[model samples]
Target: MAGTSDPLTPRAKLAVTAGKAVAAASRAAGRGSGSVIGGRVALKLDPDLLARLAQNLDVTLVSATNGKTTTTRLIAEALKAAGPVVSNALGANMPAGITSALAGGSESKFGVIEVDEKYLAGVARDTDPKCIALLNLSRDQLDRAAETRMLAENWREGLAGTKAVIVANCDDPLVVWAASSSPNVIWVAAGQMWKDDAWSCPSCGGVMQRPGDDWFCGECGFRRPTPSWVLSGDHVLDPHGSAWPIHLQLPGRANKANAASSAAVAAVFGVPPQVALERMYQVQAVAGRYDVVQFQERDLRLLLAKNPAGWLETFSLIDPPPTPVILSVNARGADGTDTSWLWDVDYTRLTGHPIFVLGDRKLDLAVRLEVANQHFQVCDSLDQAVQMCPPGRIEVIANYTAFQDLRRRVGN
Candidate 1:
């Protein structure tokens, strides 16, 4: 019986009001953004809070192992071409954080949510999104998150029978399988870099035949669907063969791929490709992913590389040889305690750069670098690493919690 026309009950209204107050207090105390704790408080007071708050809006949920925060940001900005949009812009993807975002912007006409891969189905069911964008899946947080195939199967079951039109990357075999249950799918050719996790077919336990960009299961006859939207270099070609240029302030091919996906999601909500690209071009940073700051009079560009796949993409984005590269890592719960994924990364690619490692788990990274025969210094502090380097343009690459710690230390 709950509908957009239904106003929040007195109890739900009180919960929203209380959540807002707690959120404000937390922000004032400088504890953190307070999205999670505030949402938790609200949900405890009213279990049906998220569903009620999203009733009036057209929701679009985005999920992936990597590029999630950045993709969610791009989608939210592009959707602004439609009207006011409510989004959890600070990378909070859980139900509690989602409840906080929706309650905060109760009157917004649309909602763009970035969900952790594990919780995508639950959020989709609760929000009943008009569309869902599935980017690509790779190994991430092995200790805390589900394996790629299992998660993709979870997505397949969770999204089945939902009326939401799925915009998925056909280049990823697992994503293709995940979106298979949905009748209405808008396949996009967003490239996948890490093939280690998806070498086998999720449908039949057979080896996947990946011949360049196209992948298929010879055993089960599962194949990559033809993508209506294709990303070629910096240009995105639409179904009509109209190539649109993405004038993004964010760097790297990964972000350009995100733009293509964002455009597709925006189009589902009636926003034109040109208009969406215009709005997306204005976003320079997503929670400091590509933020440049001054440290010891040097310009340090911040890049986040959490897992092996993410690290590979990030390697391509760093400045050319001899430019000092500071690599920071953490084995905290957020970054996944198993540091074994480090060995999977081709650290030899970092050979030419003057490398420095500093983090709670720098020792793990140092050992990996040593085994790869790549020269790097282990610094006790981020400032020490920066001071060791000469003049301008230092690259600071860190995983999740380390990135947060560096940002907080930089007073961002």
Candidate 2:
């Protein structure tokens, strides 16, 4: 549906009509399902419709394996701080999602959407964003995504002739390679935390050099550009109380990269470094991913892991895993119907045996956890899992659908 049409205006009109009908039906059903994109079924929509919807608005498109939501939110916040802005806050990153987000703010000056890596090119070709933020690529959703190299190819093809201000994470070779052909681009290196797992130099097939904190290719002398703003030192603090001064309101090593990437993009909008840094300190965490909740006398942490990279990063941050945890796995359409990506996650990091495992695929997760040498108490319902979970230091790992189900059950 995305590439078939000639003019986007007619397709957009049709999409709006369809969306309104669905929204009304969902409302009548007493469900908020209408806010979500691609929640019903995996029918591809025309990109022309998305292009027509973004015709008048200045658009900022963000794509990454991880941290796109946080980075998108921060970019939107920074832009809104300067003036009025519109965004799809629902975390829908597809063509229909782009349309849905635009449906909310028909008169806003700018539009920001966190796009999925696979659909980014179609969305870009359709939306024609004025600015594009290319973040790092990691192993995520391997089953659905094929592999990282394939995702990179999709990204490259989708972004051609975007005519947008390309803001890229220079440390990521794939991101850099994607932006190399772009006419106007600004490279933002993640000063201290830049990590590369590339096997050989794309340019010369030589080994890479890790000098100090940054990395460089040995043969071609290719290296990441110096950051526009470096978030160095040990103190990287986020909104949460500072255990580590370099506090990322989000958890894991990937989040620090996300924060730094957001700051780099914010600099493009003339947000002073200090002001942006201060704002980062005050920004609230996004829901479903490292969102901390309080229940009566219990402290609950909800981390979303729809893909392998996300799960691994979340696993890494949750160091010295909490005792008696809850792992929720689901295969609902919204949470990715295929749950095979579980093979990529390192469940071993969750050393302590979970007290409860919940989901449509609870046993599947239980088996995975068991293979990682952890024991689990499997439950069919989320409520049962929460009821069985102890009060202090409780953690929940959920996919998108399970999170929604768990939130509804727990009254969050």
- Return the lDDT, model 1, position 312: 95
TM-score of 1: 0.98
lDDT per residue as tens, model 2, 1-412 = 1232333365555666667677667767877747554322212344445656677777889998767887888777767766677887768776666677776676576788899888888778767787889887766543456466567667766676668888887777767667766777776655323243354554456776766666678788866665444444434332222322344466666666666666666666776545655566556677555667776567778777777756666666653645567788888766666677776677777766565888898878878877877767778775666667667767777877888877776676
Global fold similarity of model 2 (TM-score):
0.81
Residue 333 CA displacement from its true place in model 2, Å = 4.0
Residue 91, model 2: Cα distance from true site in angstroms: 0.9
lDDT of 1 by residue, 1-412 (tens): 1355755899999999898889889999998988888999999999988888888889999999889899899999998988999999998999999999998786688899999999999999888899999999998888878889899999999999889999999998888899999989999998998889888989999999988788999998999899999999888888888999989999899999999999999999889899999999989998988999987789999999999999999999899999999999999988899999998999999988999999999999999999999889999998899999999999999999999999987766
Which of the numbered candidates is closest to the native, going by highest TM-score?
A: 1
Q: Output candidate 1 Cα RMSD.
A: 1.3
